[model samples]
Target: MIALPFLKSVAPPLQGKRIYLRPPTLSDYRAWASLRAESREFLAPWEPLWAVDDLERGAFRHRIRHYDDEAAAGTAHPFFLFRNTDQRLLGGITLGNIRRGVGQNGMIGYWIGAPFAGQGFMHEALSLLIPYAFTKVRLHRLEAACIPSNERSIRLLEKAGFQREGLLRSYLKINGMWQDHLLFALIEDDARAGK
Candidate 1:
């Protein structure tokens, strides 16, 4: 198995009141695979179609390499959420598609295992991540897009202080189809004002 902590020295783990966020590691394959397999039906609607080997160990290694490459390139940050008390993986969140220079922005995407849904974990994780995006990453703006039918995601982003901007027709290919998404955004100043 691959070792742990390739990202520790780079970004380190972020801790909140009830949970923490850290970069995924090779040692996480089994738990990650198991949770994703079990939650496949629950998560598939909002995500890209999975490859035939999506949960296999080799695919996991490729996934890690992709994440590591993005981290190195400053294009994305992917974190897995773990409960503080038990360290159980509950979900994952990503601040990706980053643009610096004049843009100074990043996009957010996330998912929670079906078993852990509606437990306040994502709320806390979003709380932790917004600050990380604004302060630690020094990003000027963060954005999230969700299918209009994804009421839960809409609520989560709004509760985290994201303001709806507009809708993009066929913005992302989800579940193998081009789907419309409502766009939301939060700026650094807005984040500070909300605090």
Candidate 2:
């Protein structure tokens, strides 16, 4: 008989009041695709354009594969937000492009399904993810950028205790264009200090 070694996991799923963040699963496609298809108009403005066949079954499977690869490499931790009690998929959140060593930081990004928008689910998700990043992952800071025109997102970031740093000129290629962005940051101490 041959013995196999088991590998230990580094991170765990995070939970909040209304929602919990979990790794994306193959079973999520049906619910996820419905939200994306129904909210095409709502999400299009802030999101990159989807190809005509983007959400087809094959494409989504490929997307999940890519997300898995990034997660394994420590480049990102991507989660599909779900209602806590029911575990219904709400949307996705990510702590991406993580940098360790001297920086010890990562960028935050998220999008809520249209039906779940304005219900404060994203706020709940961020509340859980940020603290997890700080204490569990041992990151020093979390950073986010919002298109200047995204008033709702700005408000959400502020509610999560992220402070406006400055405007970054042509900072990111967003929705197919190089657009200016407002930088926001939240250090662990700032969150701990209740700022």
* TM accuracy, model 2: 0.91
* Residues 33-131 of candidate 1: C-alpha lDDT, one tens digit per residue: 999999999999999999999999999999999998898877889999999999999989998998887998999999999999988899999998899
Which stretches of candidate 2 lie above 4 Å from their native place? 1-11
In model 1, the runs with Cα more than 4 Å from the true position are 1-9
For model 2, residues 78-99, the per-residue Cα lDDT tens digits are 8889998888888999988888
As a TM-score, model 1 comes out at 0.94
- Alpha-carbon shift of residue 78 in model 2 (angstroms): 0.4
For every model shown, what is its TM-score relative to the native structure? 0.94, 0.91
